[model samples]
Target: MDTSAPVRILTVCTGNICRSPVAERLLQAGLDQAVPGGFEVASAGTRAMVGEPMQPISADIVRTFGGSPDHFAARQLTPNILRGVDLVLTMTSGHRGEVLQLDASLLKRTFTIREFARMLDVLDQRAADGVAEAGAAVVPSTADAHDGASPLAANAAYWRGLPARAAGVRHLSLPADSSENDIVDPYRRDPGVYRQMEDQLAPAIVSILRHARLNAPSAEAAAGPGS
Candidate 1:
């Protein structure tokens, strides 16, 4: 259905061509498959090799997971890019800090990609445990309770509320080790390092896609749809 702008998501990393590009493309592909025009995912780097294509290994990784890495050009992160972004998923904790340094206002909305995925996974499990959100909107009695909100608008509202909800459940979902929250950087590293990156990153991406499909608004029950 026609609606206002799609929810805007930004993925950040050191070069934009590796981890962030994979996150951006896969997320865009997954969300598009679930609900076309429902979200816009982009990527940038704190120290970008601007205009560069996705690194070969990273591009292959994207292809390995059913996402295309075509026509992607790295961009340097800026305050302007952060403006109006509904969510920001960074590759590392340091990158998350850099994102905040550019726009402190994003403190609540930004998360390390793995961390965010874990939080979503926790929420997904809670839903499976019969503790589902009343309407999947942030608040049913307040600002998010628009009766005629378009599906896209409802989607934006739901996702925009997630960081807060995720924050509230942080204690219940903390990683066993802090390092688990950050994706490993394999730039210029050996195949083993790239493998480590894949091992670390792929699961988080899967969690995100699974959770997104679980939460996406359905034509019959936006509580979820799509494979």
Candidate 2:
């Protein structure tokens, strides 16, 4: 519930070698730059991609786009993975269901990546409402309230500062008229196809980051402590 306790976010795909890793790195980069220490990002595959490296072409594409290739590795999805993850961004609707099956409580935290981005839209609106009600002149803290303090209270305080309305759950629906519950898996496909999927994913990733920031209560809390 506390958005600030290093938001544990996981990005998932069929193979960790391509899309999931790419999304993980991009989201990490964005979070590091925009909201340092506020998020912890990781990636995993639905299928066992254990001990594999990123595909050569995937590496090439990541480098071509200026993404960090050093921090990626393949791992399979599991129920325990849902424990601490604040959010789970899967490649498709089926993946979302799979994650939920692993842990039904995740039904609240998991979503197809696009759906998560859409949820961000709602969170932003709620945060805006909080901002409006608190007025335009309040200045609040940007760092975690317990940066150097106790863990339990620090965590509770962060969650408490969040807009109670925005702190509730969110869900996703498959886009209409789309047979593909996911972006077609391009893991073993041609590099061009991977690139095409990349094109689709990149924008959605940015939107997710933007929404996270817009909805980020800590930033607003820093602006108005009691707000």
Query: Cα lDDT of all candidates, in order?
Result: 0.83, 0.65
lDDT of 1 at 17: 80
Root-mean-square deviation (CA) per prediction: 4.3, 5.7
Estimate the overall C-alpha local distance difference test score of candidate 2. Answer: 0.65
Best by lDDT: 1
Cα misplacement distance, residue 114 of candidate 1 (Å) = 0.6
Q: Write the per-residue lDDT of candidate 1 for residues 4-82, one digit (tens) a residue.
A: 4788999999988888999999899988987678889999999999999999999998998899999999999999999
Worst 10 residues of 2 by lDDT: 133-142
TM-score of predicted model 2?
0.72
Instruction: Provide TM-scores for the models.
Output: 0.89, 0.72
Pairs with steric clashes in candidate 2: 139-223, 140-222, 140-223, 141-222
